[model samples]
Target: MADALITLEAVSKRFGTVEAVRASSFSIADGEFFTMLGPSGCGKTTTLRMIAGFELPSGGRILLRGEDVTEVPPNRRPVNMVFQHYALFPHMSVLDNVAFGLKLKKVPKQERRRRALEMLEVVALDGLEQRKPQQLSGGQQQRVALARALINNPAALLLDEPLGALDVKLRRALQLELKRVQSETGTTFVYVTHDQEEALAMSDRIAVMNHGVVDQIGTPREIYEHPTTPFVADFVGSLNALEVVIDEVVGDSVVCRFGEVGRVVAPAPHGASSGSTWRIAVRPERVTIGTEQVAFDGGSRLSGTLQQVVYLGMLTQYHVDTPAGRVVSHRMNDEAGLSLETGAEVHVGWAADHTSVLGPASS
Candidate 1:
């Protein structure tokens, strides 16, 4: 955090009786693509608004490049925001729309137009500068908005689900475009989105928020592979949670029993104790299913009956009914086990390192 660009120290926000954000703390590094990701009502948008000076925090402070800006107005702060709705003026051409900010600052007409055209090239919209907002496609309009924001040369760019309005295919494409623009401009991006995939694909680091709390922050791989909380594990990706009772602890591993099937040895989690029951979570893609028993060194295994096979274009999903409960496994469509029929007996296995011991199972 040596070159921290934006810092939130114990930030909290309230809307009358409801607490929207609570004691959230984190920092965005200079020129980094930092994302705030979570489901609706998770207070991510509120946090972004607070940083953009649109909403004030009820407690704590916000810093921009080491200077406290908790009370600064949006126009006075060195930041700009892009909304899901691109908010372009219908009467203006793309070039005019992009140069509007500069016009407001009384920048020379020629200079603003030159900078605006340069930004259009940066966003890959140089050829469409003369088109009105309504004449362009959704993605093109989005780039115009981006160019408009970047034309001002803000220290940080705040985006609140700017791709939320695009179709899945277009959204996926824009995720990369946004990352590229941020990289080329070297402008710090604090993007807010509820889409886990978008956050995972476009972010340098992500802060997963839940019910007003910033649960965890890490790289996409770290967050997906080693989630620190049950909410983080469940919300970020597909997880299969199995309730198991701890039988014993041996060094760095723990023996646990699930249902009447068998025991499993998993890497010992912090605070694990014998006889206590907890839910162990594993991502669907990490679990493998096979008709014949396959030994997985340093892993857990279970026997189950194949309940269903779902064919998704790029991958296949196998649902198996086990003694403990139902578990699902995902594999590429070309994987060998896709031929397994429903009702066939199958073995489910995953490495102990893939298992995450969550909070104690409900009574």
Candidate 2:
């Protein structure tokens, strides 16, 4: 991590008796789209503010481009933050708003207009330079704010839920737009948001935070496919859990007894002990339900009664109550396919490799 653009070494933040951030540590590589993702009150915003120099760390250090900036003032850090609320000046045109930062740094009048116009063009808002903030749409105003922040060419850009105000469609649109802008500029972006889908869509990597502590940090695929902790597995997506009692641990595999349903064999999770209780989780899409028996290695099949059916346009979600436990299965909707009514008997199953052994529930 010698080339890390930003590094937080055991950074923590507190307000009086309440601790907002724990001793969180991570590094962002140069030109990477990194995200701090979690629900509200998870200290993601607090960590972002600490990096922006708006909130001083209670302990540990903050480094930007190899320089220690733990005590640096907001105006002095080599980073800029874009807030959810677009604090644009109503009296000033888009061009003027973008140029305001350069002006404060004593940029010349003619040069200000030139640089401002150029940055506006970078944001695809060149022709709208003369429009005031009041006359622009919400997304347009956000672009103006972004252009203003990027005019200084900071080492990194810190965004605090910048798209939280836009409508769903608009937000989705801008997610791609922002990714394009970030790629085009080649600036490291440390984006903060609570939206897991947004993080999966735009981030090179994500740090999932919970209760002022970072639970896991990894690529979207890794976070989804192999969540290390129960908190991460449950929070990142919808998962069905099955409690099992381990009969024995054979090498890296464990033999789990599923009561009268059946016995299952799966790879033991790292650090799992022999003859201990564990939870196995599978996604709804991974759970298959049918009256027909399927053949597959390391797959667990159980009998269940279909309890509920929810019809979505693309897929049908079936909830089943099994001897092992309740499970859900998702099947694609097809024009000529048959109908599986509720209260019917069905067999539920999934590949053991698709199963993940979750950490203790209390973790």
Against the true structure, whose TM-score is highest?
1
Model 1's alpha-carbon lDDT is 0.91
Positional deviation of 296 in candidate 2, in angstroms? Answer: 2.5
Candidate 2's C-alpha runs over 4 A off are 259-265, 271-274, 335-338, 361-363
Candidate 2 per-residue lDDT, tens place, 1-363, comes to 877999999999989998889999999999999999999999999999999998889999999887899998998888999999989999999999999999999999999999999998889898999999999999999999999999999999999999999999999999998999999999999999999899999999999999999999999988888787788888888888877777777787777765664565667877667667788788888877787654556677777788999999999899999766788988888734447889998877778777888864342
* CA deviation > 4 Å runs, candidate 1: 258-261
Task: Point out the worst 10-residue segment of candidate 1 by lDDT.
Answer: 257-266
Candidate 1 global TM-score? 0.96
CA lDDT of each prediction against the hidden true structure? 0.91, 0.88
Q: How many residue pairs clash in each candidate?
A: 0, 0
Q: In model 2, what lDDT does residue 323 have?
A: 66
